[model samples]
Structure formats: structure tokens, C-alpha cells
Target: MAKAICILTGNHTAFGVVFFKSDANGCVTVKGEFTGLTPGKHGLHIHSFGDLTNGWISAGPHYNPNNEMHGAPQDEKRHAGDLGNVDVNEDGLAKLEMEIQHFHLTGIHSVIGRTLMIHQNEDDLGRAGNEESLATGNAGVGVAWGVIGICQSNISEKALEEKSNQ
Candidate 1:
């Protein structure tokens, strides 16, 4: 049982708490929240590797642990990093929670060294008809990016304790 948390801030948006849970089988549960964003559906995914070198491009490919071809989140043939989209309300806020069982947040196949990207548009899931669609979903531009890090559970617990003490 391990935990990870990240705070993501970007153009016209600010948010905190991207929670992750590493399971026994090397899967991860990804949860995210945001206070501001365009009121609409937005795309979310685990980029290839954790290296925000040159903007979003540094993240590279989806977390396809099985080396499967691209497909929708629910599709059987899809990549491992496909967690699907998140919806934002009229207040430009979002609370996203989903389980990603195909990839790990720790160990050899971990996604820790990878980055999570929030796109400005919905992922058509390769329905747009193009080769690049499989890898990128033609999902417009990236609005926010955050490097995933493994946060020890004790750290979060201590923070909670400090808050209670205060």
C-alpha cells in the first residue's frame, strides 16, 4: 500500500491533490481535483514517461503496459494509461476519480517516472480517423501537466496531524 500526491497549476487554472494508490498487482488508482477549468469535458491520461522536458512532448506515449494498440478507455484493445475523460461544471471546477489497473505507480512497471496530462478537449479515442489519433487522440493542446511522484503515506498522515494540531 503506497500513496502519491501532486499539485497541478497551469494557464488559467489551479488545482491540487492528484491522488494515487499502488495495488498489489501493480495497478494504480488515480484521483484528481481542480477548482478552475473551462466548464466542459476534458481529457485525462498518463503520458508515456515522467519527463516534462519540453512541455507536454516530454511525457511521450500512453502507459501501455501491455504494448496494446490505442483504443477507448473501456475498449479491450486500448492502452493501459487510458483512464478516459473528466467533466467540469459551470463553475469551472472538476473532481475526478478513477482506477487505473493496467499500470503501476511503483516498481519496475511503475508510472511514477511518468507525467499526467490534462487536455483542453475530449479524447475522441482514435475515432477521428488518423494514425496520430491512437497515440494522442487528436485531443487538442495540453492545458496542465504534472509530474507524478510517490508520496509516502506517512507524509500525508503527518500533514493531517499538523492540521488537526493547529
Candidate 2:
């Protein structure tokens, strides 16, 4: 499997680690552990850029290569970055795990080097009856953000060399 990881950062104490593991079929499992958030739902998305020079704003918009509308992760016509929301418990901790097909960790649709962001509000999944909802799910400002990077691969160098020679 291909693997990637992100270490979140923000202005506040909210922080976390997100992991992405993908199989050869392009199915990806997203898992994350977060803390120091409000006891409620927060939007989670993948922005187009990894830039953090100017903070979250510099990350660009959602990773919508197809220019699709904002919606849930399972939506057929949604942006690739529309990952929906994560719920925080009363103790300000959230454990998230989901399987997504919109993007993978490797190949053409890979999200590596992009920005993973935690928003300040719950995503309406494009049902909020407003233009912003269609565009951004009204997911407010980003609270935490991180850049996706490749983790150590399980495939050995010999296996990779042999595969390349095939």
C-alpha cells in the first residue's frame, strides 16, 4: 500500500496527525486523531496547494481539479477535497476514519503535497440553500492545516527495481 501523513498546525492549540493509506485499486482509507477542538463538528478538506507561507489562506481553494461543487465525500458530483465533517467529543478530541474514493495517495489523482485543512464550522454538504454552500459548503475559516507528504513505503528497493524492469 502507498502511504502518506500530515502533522497539523494552527494558531490555537488544536493539533493532530492524519494518515492516508491506499491500495493498488485506488481505494484510500483516511484516519486521523485530533485534539483541542470545540465539542462539535468541524469541516475537513484538502486544499489545492501546500503553501503555508501566509497561513491557511495561502493554501488556495479546495482541491477541485474537476471544478465540481462542494458536497459530501460520497457525493458523485462533489469536489475531490470535500471530505465532509469530523465530530469532536466533549473532551475536545476526535478520532476520524473513513474510506474515500475521490482521491488516492499515488498516481494521477494523488493528493500528496496538498494542504489538509480543518475548518471552523460544520460543512453543510451543499444543502445550505446558498451560493456559498454550493461553492464552499459554507465551511468557514480554517482552524488547522498541514501538508500531505509521503511516508516510508512498505515496498522494498529490490521489489521496486524488479517491477521497474518489468
- The TM-score leader among the candidates is 2
Model 2 spans with C-alpha error above 4 angstroms = 155-166
Candidate models: Cα lDDT each: 0.73, 0.88
* Candidate 1 local lDDT, 37-141, one digit each (tens): 788887787787777768777778777878876667778788877767778899988988776666676666677767787888888887777887877676777
What TM-score would you give candidate 1 relative to the actual structure?
Answer: 0.83
Residues forming the 10-long window of minimal summed lDDT in candidate 2: 156-165
lDDT of prediction 2? 0.88
What's the distance in Å from true for residue 143, model 2?
0.6
For all candidates, the clash counts are 3, 0
- lDDT score for candidate 1 against the true structure: 0.73
As a whole number from 0 to 100, the lDDT of residue 151 in candidate 1 is 82
Tens digits of per-residue lDDT for model 2 on 1-166? 8888888889678887887888777889888888888889999999999999999999999999898989999889999999999999999899999999889887778999999999999999999999999988998998999999997788543443344336
TM-score quality measure for candidate 2:
0.91
